[model samples]
Target: MQDALAAHPVWVIVVDYILGAIMWTLIGRAAMNIFLPEDSNFFFMRFFVRATDPVLRLFRPITPGFLIDFLVPIYVAWFFFMIRFYLMPWLLGYSVMGMLSFPLESEIAALLYQAFNR
Candidate 1:
C-alpha cells in the first residue's frame, strides 16, 4: 500500500485525505441540519454551515425544488463521496485498492516503519 502511494506524487495522498475529510464534514453538517433547530447557536453548527454552504450552493441550481432542504446536504455529501470513492482512485491509479483499508494500512505502515527505525 505504501508502495502504491509512493508510486504517485505526494499530492494525490494529500488530496485524498482532504477530500475524505470534506466528505465527512458535509455528512456531519447535513445531520446537524436535520436534527437541530435552525436557530441553534452552537459554534460547530455555525462552522459547519459556513464551511459547507458554499459547496452546497454550487449544486443548488440543478437540485429540484421539491426535494426538501435536508436533501441538499445529503446530495452534496454524495457528490463528494463519488469524487473521493470513484474518481480519485482511478485518477491516482489505485482503483483496485479498498478505500478505507488503504488509509489504515498507510497509517499502520508509517507507525511500524518509525518504530523499527528509531
Candidate 2:
C-alpha cells in the first residue's frame, strides 16, 4: 500500500481528492433534489447548487436534452467519476484500466479499517 502511495506524485493525489469531492457533491445534490427545490434556501442545497452549477454548465453541451433537469447532476457526476477512475490512472501510466485511482477514498477506507479493527 505504501509503495502504491509513493509511486504517484503528490499532485495526482490532490487531483483525485478534488475530483472525488466534486463527484460526491454532485451525487449529494441529486439526492437532495428529491426533497427540495433547486431554489431552496436550505444551506446544504444552496451550497450544492452554488458549488456544482459551474460544473453542470460546463457539461451542458454534452448533457443529453432528454435527461430531465433533476437528473443533470447525476449525469455530470458520472463524467467526473469516469475521469477519476479511468483518466487519472492512465495519466499515472498504469497498464491496467480501472486501477485504484481514488486516493481520497483509499485513505478514508484505511482509516475506517484501523478504527474498527482496533
Candidate 3:
C-alpha cells in the first residue's frame, strides 16, 4: 500500500508512457498512408501498419480529412486522457479535468460498455 501511494504522482513516468503510445500511433498512420498510395516495401510497412491498425480500424470507414478527420494524434491524446483520468487518478489523486470529463465520457463509455459488457 505504501509503495503504491508513493508511485502515484510521478510526472516523468506518466509522460513517457503517453508519449510511447503516441509514437506507436504515428508509426501506424504512416504505414497506412504508405500502403494506400502503392504497394512498396511491404516488409517494413507491415510492422507499423499492424501496430496501429487496431485503433485506426475503429475509425477506418470514415475518410481522412482536415482537422476533425486528422484523428490520429487526437486519438493518442484521448487515450492518454482516459488512462490518466479513469486509471491513474486513484493513485495520483484527483485530477480536475478528469473529474470534470468523467460524466461526459461516462455517457459515452457506458453506452459502449452496455453494448459490449455482456
Instruction: List CA RMSD, all candidates.
Output: 4.9, 2.1, 14.6
Model 2 lDDT per residue over 59-116, tens place: 9999999999999999999999888877777777885444444677777777899999
Quote the positional error of residue 117 for candidate 3 in Å.
Answer: 50
- Separate clash counts for every candidate: 0, 0, 0
Q: After superposition, which runs of candidate 2 have C-alpha atoms over 4 Å from their true positions?
A: 1-4, 97-101
- Tens digit per residue, CA lDDT, model 1, 1-118: 5664766567876776677677778888878887785467998888888888788778889777898787777877788777766777788676656544445346766789999997
- lDDT per residue, candidate 3, 3-117, as tens digits? 3225444563445355446554554555466445324466555555566556566655553555443356455545556565656555545554434243333345667888998
Model 2 residue 32 CA deviation (Å) reads 0.9
What's the residue-level lDDT of 46 in candidate 3?
Answer: 54
Candidate 3: global Cα-lDDT? 0.51
Give every collision pair in model 1: none
Candidate 3 lDDT score at position 39: 43
Q: What are the Cα lDDT values of the candidates?
A: 0.73, 0.86, 0.51
Q: Could you tell me which 10 consecutive residues in candidate 3 have the lowest summed lDDT? A: 97-106
Candidate 3 wrongly placed segments (more than 4 Å): 1-6, 9-23, 27-39, 59-77, 85-87, 90-92, 96-118
For model 3, what is the error of residue 90's alpha carbon versus the real structure, in angstroms, after optimal superposition? 6.2
